[model samples]
Target: AQTVTQSQPEMSVQEAETVTLSCTYDTSENNYYLFWYKQPPSRQMILVIRQEAYKQQNATENRFSVNFQKAAKSFSLKISDSQLGDTAMYFCAFRRGGGSNYKLTFGKGTLLTVNP
Candidate 1:
């Protein structure tokens, strides 16, 4: 079974400042996928970014990027030019490479507060 861990329970970043959320996973499968999801107070789980295990290159989306270490099984999310809207509960998730039920297993979550 794969388990995701977020060491930090809470984090705060000034508006426009950069923030990095840590995540580590335990899995034996070489082929898998990692994801970073953000849930605002509205409670909608939005996909921030995804990294394929086989890909050496990290994934980026506008202001978001991931540092994927396959050997370490670590996938951390970096939020650059953070904004007030980026203040949300960030969760790291994982899914099997090829399965009929690609259900995501999420971390406990990291509450990020952006102070303006």
Candidate 2:
């Protein structure tokens, strides 16, 4: 039971341009792990990129990137050049593939407002 779906509750970008935030997930196990968390405004919880479900090459960080679509389980997050500290509240996470209280199963957020 791994579910993550961020249908953009709020999003804005202008400082530089480029923004794509949309995700969908519902797993029934096949090795799982996908995350993209960034909560600013003093809520601190940052780790904006991670994907490994047998890895099909889709997980980058320098401006953040991911578009892992393992058979329609979509996972998307692409923010490039957009600065302004990347105003945050972007969470689309999931965890399951092992053990050890791998908690994390979120996605009801997408409040990224970066405008300068």
Candidate 3:
């Protein structure tokens, strides 16, 4: 079984600044995938970034990047040059790799408020 945890329930960042959201997971499975999902007011779950457990390199997508520490079971998201549009509920999720069961375990979420 896998479980994701977001220590911070809420976070704030000034516009054009940067913010890092922390996440930790517990899982016995060696192969899995970690993901950061953004849900805006529209309530759409958007894929911010994804990282494979086997990959040593951190995953990055534009201003959104993830610091993946496999040994520590920690995956944190860094949002650079935060914008008003970045304000949303961010969730950390996990899914097992290579199986018929594609179930995802998600954290409670962290509501990020980007202030101007």
Candidate 4:
């Protein structure tokens, strides 16, 4: 079983500023994937970034990056130069690497408000 947790239910950041959203997970599986998904007001799940459990390096995509600490079971997202378009519900997710079950367990989500 795997569970993701976002301690901050809501967070606000100023435009062009940087913000880090915290996420933690508990999983028994050794091989897995961790991801940060953004769902805007339009309700589309966009893959922000992903980190494989076996990879030592963190995953980054453009202005979005993740700090993956496997030992601590922590995977936090850092948004550099936050924009108004970045305002959305951010969800932390987990998926086991193998097996037929492709289920993605997601967190409740954190509402990020990018203020001008």
Q: Runs in model 3 with CA error above 4 Å?
A: none
Tell me which residue pairs clash in candidate 4: none
| Candidate 1 regions with alpha-carbon error over 4 angstroms | none
Question: What would the per-residue lDDT of candidate 3 be over residues 27-83, giving only the tens digit for each residue?
Answer: 999999999999999999999999999999999999999999999999999999999
Q: Per-residue lDDT tens digits of candidate 2, residues 34-67?
A: 9899999999898988999899999999988999
The RMSD of every model to the true structure, in order and in angstroms, is: 0.7, 10.7, 0.6, 0.5
Clashing pairs in 2: none
Candidates in order, TM-scores: namely 0.97, 0.34, 0.98, 0.98
Task: Arrange candidates by lDDT, descending.
Answer: 3, 4, 1, 2
Q: Which RMSD does model 3 reach against the true structure? A: 0.6
Q: Which of candidates 2 and 3 is the stronger one according to lDDT?
A: 3
Model 3 accuracy (lDDT, Cα): 0.97
Q: All models: lDDT?
A: 0.94, 0.90, 0.97, 0.96
Residue 73 in model 2: lDDT: 94
lDDT of 4 by residue, 1-116 (tens): 78899999999999999999999999889999999999999988999998999999999999999999999999999999999999999999999999999799999999999999
